[model samples]
Target: MNALTLASASVKSRPLHATLCVLAAGAGIALLCAIFLLSGAVERSFIRNAQGIDVVVGAKGSPLQLVLSTVYAADVPNGNIEADQAKRIEHDPRVAKAIPLALGDNHNGYRIVGTTPDYLSLYDASFAQGKVFEKPFDAVAGALTHLKTGDSFLGAHGLAADSDDIHHYHAYTITGVLKPTGTVLDRLILTQVESVQQLHAHPDLGDPDAAEDLKISHEVTALLLKMKSPLSIMSMPRQLNKTSNMLAANPGYEMARFSRSMGFGKEVLTALGAGFVALSALMLLSALASSLAARRYDLGVLRVLGASPFTLSCTVIAEGMMLSLAGAVFGILAGHGMAYLVAVNIDSLQGLVLPQSFLHFGALDGALLGMGAVTGLVAGLVPAVSAARTDIAGILARGRA
Candidate 1:
């Protein structure tokens, strides 16, 4: 029989050993694959949401926190900037557009964002049902939020999903349901800035005079700014930080720093994956070497039956490749499966909707497969050489003895 048939027979003979090799290799590949999938999805989501805004002007605090809290809605705000002062920045010559965000409440787990209709235009958001909020206490629910048009819900006082401090004085009526944009907007409840102001100001609306006084001292969580030009982007943040109480942060710069900080953990996981892969290669080598020793007599008989030395060597190499490739395929599936689970179940990764496909093949996947195949080939080479150089007469004599 041919080298391929011989290779198949040899692998079939050692089911347990083959399975061990496959599992070992698969573990390594799965880790690497999952890392790539999850990291890419997170990076894309962050970058996409961070777009349109050149600078985020918020109350003085951690710039990264400001970006995360304002842009991604993943954290609590730094503090609030005076609404009048933020409005002055809106009229700045360098500012093309400024959308004010008033935060500090939630319904269920979704954040309630108070902003103008221009906020919808910034994200190119479209309505799936009804229309945008035009009056105080009118709300527009995100596609993923539980509320639908005409529905009403009282806002919880805090950002936490389980906050019991509900604003019973006023309930927000859902005027619209936004189409899913796969961005932060999908998880936000949008309403007019006045709605948020009224909710917090008139917690006890029975005191109308007290509520009016509170209205005069309005504050916004942040200002999402689009600059007039490239020069404005570079100059505006420095100007704002120096001249005003608000801190202006570049989303791109903050995200880059965030990515760098995250790189350390990624490197650790990658190193572990590499170690497992190397161990798998060594295990494969040991298994092949042992198999070669046990099959020397059979190989000798094959040589006598007109199989060339080249064919015998090829058989051993082919067997190694088959086992490794099986592992690679299984690893890829397992890795993406893990990533999918993380995307759906993890609240932190809720902003991103990862590819739900079972086998999402990409350039990195091909590289992984190639790495596995190469590992197998390298592991098999020594045993293949030993098989090719086998002394047929000596092997037959030993077998007869």
Candidate 2:
């Protein structure tokens, strides 16, 4: 019989042992696959969303929190800074662009970022529908916003446009819906910074009674600054902190900090996966060793019929290879399916989209499969060698004893 037929017969003859080997090998591979998929997806999402902007200027607090708040809209602002201070940074020779961020309002749980047209330019973004806000009360929605055509955002004060409501307010028109950037920007309701000031300042603006009593303080949550060169990156932050109450933090640095803090758990998962693979190899070795004992009489009949010791060893090794191949095949399919399901759910809730290429089982996957096969091959070697060294006379004597 051919090697394939022999291996199939061997597996079919010992169904329980074969099934145990398959499950052991598959479990190791499944965990490894999950680690690869999750890590790749998160890394790609972070890289894509964090491109362009170099420095974040905000009130003194946690640098990581400032990065998360400004870049992802994932947190509330630390504190407010003077808009004039932000504008000064804008006009600085070393500064390329500065985008103002005003916070304090939320449509449901999502934060609203009030910034200028420069903010959209920073992302190089475009609308999937409608246009940018043109007037004071107008607003633009992100891709994930549930607002539809002709929907209006009523101010917190319960007043709408062209109305004489008790409290002063403005009606924000839903002019545009941005295409999903797979970034935190996808979750924001963006409007001009001046517009937000106007909304909050409305009570004092037209009323002489309120205007005389108004002690106004126009402030912003943070500022996104792009530098002209790498040199300014070092000097600007130092100057800003020494010169003003605001602190400058590098997004890239804070992102690294956040990733390092988060990545420790993922590394632990990887170590656990590696341990499983090693344990799987050991289990396969034991299974082969045990099976050889039960098949001693059959092996003896084959040897008497002229099968060499080498041939017996080859048969045992072939069994190991067959099990590895079957496990790898099933593991790969299961891994890919799991990745697809995870990606779909994450895209729905987090807007962190992953491309098809991210989950491909290309070179890295092939290397893992090869390692599994090698592990299986090694697992059979000791058992195969022992089986070949077995003496038929001694076996018969032991049976009689």
Candidate 3:
């Protein structure tokens, strides 16, 4: 029989063992694929959130927290910086623009940001419908805001408030809708920074601020500053810290810091993945060795029937190659299926209005699949060697005994 035919018969002879090997190898491969997808997705999410802003200046707290709160709209602010301070920082020769954020209230879980029209341009926010918040209390809704024109968002109060509550308590009009930015900005309720300050300023329970000038509030949540040139950023934060109560952090700095922490975890997980692949290889070798010990007489019969040592080696190696192919293919499908499941579930959970054209796939996924195939092929080597060294006479005598 040809090497291919012999290999096929050998696999059929030990179907259970072959199937088990494929399963074991596939499990390791699936894990590798999952690691690649999840870690990559997280990194992508971070990048998406911090796309254009060069530096963030906020109240003295964690830089990452400031980014999360103001940029991503993830959490409430710890404190607010003065509006004049934000404007002074904006006037720096190195500073291109500063988009001040005044945050205090929430429309449901989403934050309400009071900032200038510059924020709309800075974040590239557009109108999905209607326009930006033009008049005070004439607030524009985020893509995620539960409120519409006639509909009012349940502010701090759970139900629609009466005129007394609407005027004094935490309530806002849903005048316009922001286009999806695909970032945390998409989830905010945006209005003039003065409007946000007023939400907190009025002494009476029902009276929000009647003041039109924003300088009166004297507080803002954060400032997003873009540098004229990135090189100009080196001493700018030091200069600003000397004059103001705010702290400045480069987005690139935090991105690298986070990447190192993430990379350390990835390295540990990768090593563990490699260890599992090694164990699978050893199991495959033991199985092949055991099968060879039992089949020595069969090998001798094949040799007597004119099968050359080279053909015997090819037959055994071909069986291993077949198993590797099967295992790798199954692993790839399982991995892809898992990635799809995560993407689907995340979409549902966040209710993020992602555009159809936003999906990004790259060479990294392909490289991971290739690594899985290599792992499987490496696992199959021991059995291939055992089959090549079968001794006919010795096996025949041992079988006879």
Candidate 4:
């Protein structure tokens, strides 16, 4: 019979051992694949959303926090800056464009962002249904929010969906719905700056003076700025942080630092995956080596039946290869399957939505598959060689020992 047929029979005979090897290898590959896919998606999302914005200015606090809250909408803001102060920065000659963000309330779990129409242009957003908010209390829902035009909802006082502090004073009407841009915009509810101001202006509903005072002294959570020149990037943030009460953060720099901080966890996961793979390889080697004793008599019979030593060796090698290849294939599939699960459920895990492209298999996945195949070949080599140099005469004389 052929080497492949012999190998197939051998693997089937030791189903438990073969299955264990596949599971071990699959566990390792799953960790590595999930890390690669998740990290890549997060990096892409950060870069895409941070584009067009040069500096994020918020009340003095962590630069990273400012970037995370204003640019990614992933964190709570440090504090609020005066509207007059933000406007002063906006009119500066160094500033190309400045968009003020007033964040506080939410409808269900989605944040209601108060900003000008310029915010839509920053993301190159388009209408999936109607138009942008024109009057105070008019709103634009995101594609993922599932809120249709003409629907109205009361804003919760806090960022949490379950906040009991609801602003029942005014209800926001959805004037438009934004097409999916695969950015933070997809998860937000957009409205004019006055809408958020009105929602929060809890000015002792009995006092007109309190209401007027709030309108005149409005505060915004953060300012998203675009610099007039590349030099402004270095100058503006430094000048603002040192001279003003605001924290100025460069999105690119903060994100790079965030990535570096995440690298340690990724490295730890990679080490664990490598360890599992090594353990599987060693298991494969031990299994093959131990099985040789039982197979020696068979090898002797094959030798006497006109099979050359080279043919006998190939049969042993084929068994090792089949087991290894099966493990590799199983590992790759498990890895990607884990990644897909993580991607679909990312909202609950991290409060962020990853794009569908996160599940794509690329050249890196192919490289990983190749690495698995190579690992199998290496693990099986020594066992194959030992089988090749079997003492045929001794095995036949001793019979099936």
lDDT of 2 by residue, 1-401 (tens): 74457667988898888988988887777777777777766776676666778889998988788887777766656777877877887899999888888876556445556788778776677888888877665677877768754677654421112333222466677788888776666777788776666766666356553441122227777888889999888889888878878889888878888889989998998898788878888888888888777787766666777778887888888888778666766666666666667766664336555435445777657867887788779988997898688797776666622
Worst 10 residues of 2 by lDDT: 158-167
Model 1 poorest 10 in a row by lDDT: 208-217
* Candidate 3 regions with alpha-carbon error over 4 angstroms: 1-15, 74-76, 116-151, 157-170, 173-182, 203-217, 294-306, 336-362, 396-401
TM-score, prediction 3: 0.78
Candidates, ranked, lDDT = 1, 4, 2, 3
Q: Give residue 388's error in model 1 in angstroms.
A: 1.5
> What's the TM for model 2?
0.80
- Candidate 1: C-alpha lDDT: 0.86
User: Which of the numbered candidates is closest to the native, going by highest lDDT?
Assistant: 1
My TM-score estimates for the predictions, one after another, are 0.92, 0.80, 0.78, 0.88
Pairs with steric clashes in candidate 2: none
Q: Give the Cα lDDT of each candidate.
A: 0.86, 0.73, 0.66, 0.81
Better of 1 and 4 by TM-score: 1
What is the alpha-carbon lDDT for the whole of candidate 4? Answer: 0.81
Residue 21 lDDT, candidate 4, scale 0-100: 67
Per-residue C-alpha lDDT of model 4 across residues 17-113, encoded as one tens digit per residue: 7798677666777677777777776777788888899999999999998898888878888988998998899899999999999987799988999
Model 1 pairs whose backbones collide: none
C-alpha-based local distance difference test score of model 2: 0.73
